[model samples]
Target chain A: MTKREPFFWITVSCGIIVLAFILLPLIEMLSAPSAVMLKETLKDKDVVRSIWLSMYTALAAACISFVFGTPLAYVLARTNFHGKRLVESIIDLPIVIPHPVVGIAILSVAGKNHWLGQIMSELGVRIMGSVTGIITVLTFVGIPFYINAAKDGFEGISPRLENVARSLGAPMFSTFFRITFPLAWRSMLVGLIMCCARAISEFGAVVIVAYHPMIAPVMIYERFESYGLKYSQPVAVWLVLVCLSLFLILRILALPKKNRNHD
Target chain B: MIELHNINVRLGQFRLKNIDLNIDSNDFFVLMGPTGAGKTVLLEAIAGLVPLEYGRITIAGRDVTGTAPEKRGVSIMYQDYALFPHLTISQNISFGVRYHAKAKSESGSRFERLVRELNIGHLLKRYPETLSGGELQRAALARALMVEPQVILLDEPLSALDPGFREEIRLLLKNLHESSGMTFFMVTHDFAETLSLATTAAVMNNGIIEQAGNVQEIFQKPCSTFVADFVGMKNILPAIFNKHTSRIGSLTVEMATIPVDTGGFIAIRPEDIVISTHKPASSMCNSFYGVVSAIIDQGFSYEVHVQVEDITFKSLITKGSLIDLGIREGLVVHLSFKATAIHCF
Candidate 1:
C-alpha cells in the first residue's frame, strides 16, 4: 500500500464524519420498523394514496419545469443582455425564499383579490386545497434547479460547433435540435431528477397550500403531530426510500460515459 | 468569388477596421498574420458568423451582408475540427445535407466520394473524440465539402496538427481546392503554408490588412514594416533616401533606382546577404566590414549576426560555408549584397 500522510488521514476522517452525519438518521429510521410494520403501512389506503400522490405531483412538476425552463436556460447560457444578472437572480429567488413564503406567494397570485386570481376563478381553476396548488408550489421551488443545471450544460458546449453547423447550411433551429440538444440532454435529465427529488421531499409549502390531498411528507407530519413517532416513522421511511432511489438514478445518469455508452 | 468592402467589425475592444479585399473564384487565398490580428474574426465575418459593424460582403455575385450563414452558401472549418461529439464521423459529415434540398439529393454520391478522397472510410462510425487529430481534420474537411458551399473558410486549419499531419492535410486541402473549384479562404501564420498552398494572400496586423496581393509579391514587396517583419525579413532599418543613395545608420547604401519618397523603411531578406572573410572587388553596390556578434545554429543553417557601424545584419549561411570561412563569434567579417536585394516601403 502507498504511504499515507497525516493530511490524507485527516481528510478521510472528516469524510467519514460527514457521511455518518447524513446516513445515520436514515439508516436508523429504515431499520427501526419491522417487516410486518412496513407491510401494514403499505396496506394502509391513505399511506399508499399519499405516496402515489407525492410521486405523481413531483413528476408533474419536473415535467412542467423542463418544458418551460429549457428555452430560458438556453438563452441565459448563450447570450449576454442588459439585466441578465437580475433575471438570473429572479429565477433563483424561489430557492432562497422560505418554502411557506413560496406557498403564500402562489396563493396571493391565485386568490380572488388579485387579477390573476380573479382570472383563475373565472376559469374555474382553484389553487387552494387542491393537487394544482401542490404542483404549483413544487414547480415554483423546483424550476430554479432545472434551469441552473440546463444552463450549465448548454454553457459547457462550444458555440463554435453551432457556428460550424450553421455554416454547413443548417439553420439555427435545426442546429439546436441536431447538435445542441443531444449534447445537453443528459444534464437536463439530471436536472429533472433533482427537481423531482426536491419536490417530493417538500413539506412546509405543500402543507400550507394543499393539506386536504396530503402528500407523503404532510402525512408523515400529520401522523407525527397526532399519533407519535411509532405511526410517522413508517411513512417517513418509505419517503426516504423513494428519494434515495431518485438520487441513485441521478448519480447513474451523471456518471461520465465510458466510450460514449451510458454504462 | 468573394469581395469585402469597408468591412469594419468591433468585438469588445478588438476591431477589424476598414478592410477591402477581393478574392477570385477558384483561388486558394491565405490570410497570414500574428496572433490577435483578427484574421479569424475577418474569416468569421465573411461567413456571417460575426456581426459586422459596417461592411458589405458579396459571395459569388450575391450581396450577403444581411444573410444568415446557411443562406450565404459558405462553410467554415475550425482548427479543432469542432465535430459534434455526439455524432459519428459519417453523421457529422452529412449533418448539413438535410437542410439543403440539393445537397440532400446528391449527398449519397458526394459522401462516398468525400470519404474515399479523404481516406476516412474506416472512420465513418467513429466518434470525434475517438479519432486522431488528422482523422478529425479529414472528417471536418469532408463535412465542409459535402455541403457544396460556394466558399469555404478555414481558420488556421493545420495549426493544431502535428508536423506530419500538417503536411498530409495540407496536401489534402490543396487537392480539394483544385478539384472542387470552390473558393478556399484560409488563415494561417505559417509562411510555408502560404507559399505552398496560396495563389494569393494577405497579411494582417492589429485588425487591419497591411498588405494584400500575389503571394510572391507580398513576400517580395511587403507594403509596410509590419508585413515585412511578419514575413521574416530580419534586417529592417529606417533610411533617408536621396536619389540613388540611401543612408541607413551611418552607412550609405546605393540603390539600383531612385525611390520616389524621401525617407522610409528598407527591409532585406537574411538569405540575400553574402558573408565573406575578405572584402572582394565586386560590382555589388553595398559592402560593409563588421565584427561577427553572434552565430545561432538554425538546424539547417547558421545565422551569422554581423555588426557594422550602428547596424546589425543577419546572414543565413550553410554549415559548409561556415567551415570554409571559419566563421564564429567575435570574428571580423565582410558582408556584401546587391542594392536590388533591399526592399524599401
Candidate 2:
C-alpha cells in the first residue's frame, strides 16, 4: 500500500514473469490429468520399480562419491602440489560437458570391451548393462558437486585449528576426523545432497550406460515416445511429484541446526 | 630447553634466515619484533608446524629436526585462541589429554584441576563463539597446559584481548609461570608486555635476531638501531665518539666509554633522560639546555620532547615532576643523564 518506486514495480513484475514461466508448465503438467490417472501411474509396477531403481542408484552413487571425494577434497583444500589446478579442472569437466558426451566418455573406459571394463569383468564387477554402469555414469556426472562443496567446507576451516590440535598432541589423521571433519560436516552434507539430487535426475548418461534396468527418467522418455501425451504426461507428473517431495525432505535434513555457529 | 641451530624458512616474501635461538629451561623467553618480521613463523618452526628448510631444532638436547608436532612435546597457543568451535569448553580442554595414552587415564582429574585453576569451571558447556576473548584465552591456555608440554609457545596471546582483560590474563600467566616453573616462549610486539613478563627476550628484525639478552639488559643496552627503535627508544641520534666524549649534532655528550672512534649512533632511552627546570648538582656527565617542543600525557607519565639546537630529545617525566617543573611547549628546560646511560651501536 505504501507508494513504491516505478523501478521497483518493474523489477517485481519481471521476477514474477520469470517465476511464472517456470511454475506454469509444472502446474499445467500436474493438473493436466485427473487425480485417478496419477493414482494409476503410481500403481503401475514398472513405474514403481523404475522410481525405486533411480533412488537406489542415486544413493549408491552418492555413497561412492562420499568415500573417495572426501579425502580428495581435504587434500585440495589443505595442500598445494604440482598439477593441482589441472586435477580440479578435470573434476569439474563433467559439469560443463554435454550429458551424452559424458555418456560416450564413460563408455570409452567403462564399456564391456574396454581395458578398464575387462579388468572390472575379471574382478566379477561388470560395468555394462548392470547397476554398476548406472552408478558409474551417475557418479561421473555428480562428483564435481561433492568434491567442490567438500573442498569449500574444508577451506572454510582455519588451518590454525588443525595446527593447534597437532600442537596439543593430536596425530594428523585424528585431527582430520575429530576437528576438520566435524567443522566441515554441514557443507559436506549439503554437497552430498546436491550430488544425490543430480544423480537421481540423470537420464541421458544412464540410458546409454544401462538401458534394461530402466531408471525413472528413461522410463518417462520411453513412455512418451510409444504412448504419446495421455499416458506419458501422467507418469512425468508422478516422477516430478516423487522427485520434488524427496528433494524437499533431503534439503530440510541438510539445513543447518539452529545452534550452528554464525561464522 | 629449546634450541634452534641456523633455522631457515622461506615463506613467499618473508624469509627467516640463519635464526639461532636458545631458550633456557624454566625461563619465560619473549621474542619481540615488528609486524612481518617472521616472529610467528619462527614460533611455528619450533612447534613443528612449518618445515625447516635448513638447520635443526633440538628440545631437551634431543635432535627433533624431522619429528612431527604431536611427538615433539611442544604446544603453541595462537593469537586468536583457535579454540575448536565444534567442541564444548570441557571437550576442548580435554582434547589433548584424551589423545595421548600416557595422559588418558589421568585426564579426568587433570581436566577438573585445569578448569578449576583457570576459573573456567562454570563455562564447561559453552562453545568458543559464545565466550568472550578473555574466556577463550583461558580456555586455550588450559588446553595447552593440559598436555604438560616441555615448552609452551604463545603467539601474541594478549594482542586480541581488551586492555583490562589483557592485564587480567597477564597476571594469570605470570602466576602460572611462577607456580609451575614451566618454560614459556611468547612472541609479542608490545614492549610493556616484554618488560612485565619476560625473563629473557630477543629483538628480531626482517627475520633475524638483532639482539638477545636478559630483559632489563636488552632494554637498557640495545646493540643495534633496529633493537632500539623496536623497543620504543625515541632518542637515537647520530653521534661521533672520541675518547669518552661523544658529539651528537651540536650537543657534546660525555659517556663512560666510547665503542667507536669516529661515527656511531647513540641510543638514549626516554626514561633515562631526566628533565628539570635548572641543571642540578648531580653526577650526570651529560647535560643539555633545551626548550620543550611537545608534551604528551601517557597515562602513567608525561613524555616531554625537548629541542636542543637541532636534535629533539625525548624524556619521560612523572606527572608530579611535570606539575612541579610546570613544563609546557616552548618552555626552556635542562636534560641530564649519567655517563653510563648512553648506548652506542
Candidate 3:
C-alpha cells in the first residue's frame, strides 16, 4: 500500500496563517509597552476610573442578559411557535448590524425627545450621558452573543430530562430550577463571559450614548486622538490584561469538578 | 384504576383519535404497538404530559384531566433513563423527597433502602454519565419509585438493556411490582417483554386501540388482522366464510363454532400447528400435506415453512422434534391444527 501525501502540508500551512492572524497583534500589544509605561497608565486616575466603570457596567449588562436571555433561550429551545425563526433572526440582528447603527437605533427609542425618553425624563431618570445609557448600549450590542450561546446550551439538553423531573413530583418551576438550570449552567456561563467581553470592548455605541462617563474603549480612543499613539497603547494593554485575567478566572470557576466528567 | 375516555391528541401530522383505555389498579398494563403508533403519546396523555383535545381521564375514580403531572401522582421512566448528568446518584434519587414531605420525613432510612433495593449503593457518589446503561436504568427506576407515585409510566424500560441484562431487569421489575403493588403503565414493541411482564395488554395501531384485554387472551385470540400480525401470528390466510364452513388454502374449516358470515382472514399461531410425517388420526379440524420449503432454526424451536399448493404455512416445532422426525427441506409433511386454535378476524 502506498501512503498519500502533500495535501497535509497544504492544510497545515493554511491553519498556520489563520493562527498567526489572531495571535501576532495580541502578542505585540502585550509585549511592546514598557513596564513603567503600563504601570503609569494603571496609576492615572481617569484611566483607573474608566477601567472600573467599564468593568462594572459590562458586568451589569451581562447580569441583565443572564436574567432575561435565559428564558428566551429556553423558549426557543423547548417550544414551537409561528415566527420563531424570525424572532431568532431579530435577536441576532445586533451582531450583524454596525455598532454605530445599533447606537442610533437605541437613541431613536430612548433619546431625549423620544416618547420613552420623555417618560423617563419626567421621572427624573436620564437616558443620555448616564450610567443607565451605557449599560443599555452594552446590553443592546452584547445580547445576541449571550442568547445564542445559552440557546445552544438549552438545545444540547434532552427534553426527556425535564419531562422525567416533572413526572417525579416536581412542578414546572421546580423541574427547571433543579434539572434544566443546572444542566445548562455551563453554556449560560460561557455566554455570559462572551457578553461581558463584548460589552467591555464596546466603543461606537458607548461613545455615542454616554461619552461623558467614558468607558475603557472610548477613553483609549480619546487618548489616541487627543495626545498620540503612546498615550493610548498602555491603556489598551491594561484593558486587555484585565479582561484576559477575568475571562480566565470565570472560565476556571465554571469548569466541572475534576472527579466528575461532563456528559 | 385509570381510564382514558375517547382521548384525541393532534401532534403535528400524527393524530391519535378516540383512544379509550382502562387500566385496573395494580395491573401491569403493557401497550404494544409498532413505531409511530402513538403508544408514547397515549402514555404521556395518561400522565398529563400531553394534553388531550377530546375526552377526559379518570384516575382512581377521580377526574384528573386538568391536573398537572405532579398533582396526578404519576411518574415516568424514559428509555434513556434521563438521570440528571450533573447530580450524583444519591442526590438524583432523593430529588423528589422535598415535594412529598411525608416521604421526606422517613427519607433517611428510605434512601438507604432504595439504594440497596436498586443495587446502586456503591454508585451514590458517581455522576450519571459515569454509570453503565443498566446502572442508569436502576437509578432512574429508583428515582421514580422514590416519589411513591401511584401510577408509574415506563417507555420501553428494557429496550436500552443488553440482552444479558434484560432478563435480570425484567425479574427485578416483576419483583418490584409484586412488593409495591404500583400500577405500571408501560409501552413496548417487543412481544416477549409484553408476554412475560404484562397482566393486561393493549395493541395500538395508527393511534387507535385495536384490542385490549387479558394478555393471554390477547395473545391467543386477536380480534383484527393488525393485532394478529403484530402478536407474532404468522399464518394469516385470507379466506371466504359462509354460515357453515370457511375455505382456506383448498381446505374447509368448520365455522359453526365461530360466528362470522363475511369473508375475513384466519390467523393461526405457528406454535399451535402440529407437524408429523404421516397422517395421524387425531381429532384436529384441519389437516394438510405439503413439501417442506424451509426449516429455520430459532434456537429453542425450528420454524418449518411448508408449501401446500400456492399457500405457505409456517409451523413451529421443538428442536427435539426436528431431530426425531429428521425434518429436512423438500420432505412431505402433514400439518394439523385444532378448530379452536384458529382465530378468524
- What does candidate 1's lDDT look like per residue over B239-321, in tens digits? 99998889998999988778889999889999999999998678787998999999999998999999998999999999999
Candidate 2 residue-wise lDDT, B228-269, digit = tens = 887878899989888888888888888887676588899988
Most TM-score-accurate candidate: 1
Task: Tell me the tens digit of each residue's lDDT in model 2 across A92-179.
Answer: 9989998988788887887567888789778998666788889999999889999999999999999999999999989999998999
* TM-score for each predicted model, relative to the true structure: 0.96, 0.94, 0.95
DockQ of each: 0.65, 0.58, 0.61
Q: Could you list the chain B TM-scores for each candidate?
A: 0.98, 0.94, 0.94
**Which residue pairs show backbone clashes in model 1?**
none
Question: What is the alpha-carbon lDDT of model 1 when measured against the actual structure?
Answer: 0.92
Candidate 3 structure quality by residue, lDDT tens digits, B22-105: 999999999999988999888888888887888999998989999998888888988888898888898999888999977889
**Candidate order, lDDT descending:** 1, 2, 3
Predicted candidate 1 versus true structure: per-residue lDDT over A147-254, tens digit per residue: 999999999999999999989888888989988998999899888988988899888888888998999999999999999998999998888787788789778977
> Rank order by DockQ, top first?
1, 3, 2
Report interface Cα RMSD per prediction.
2.4, 3.3, 2.7
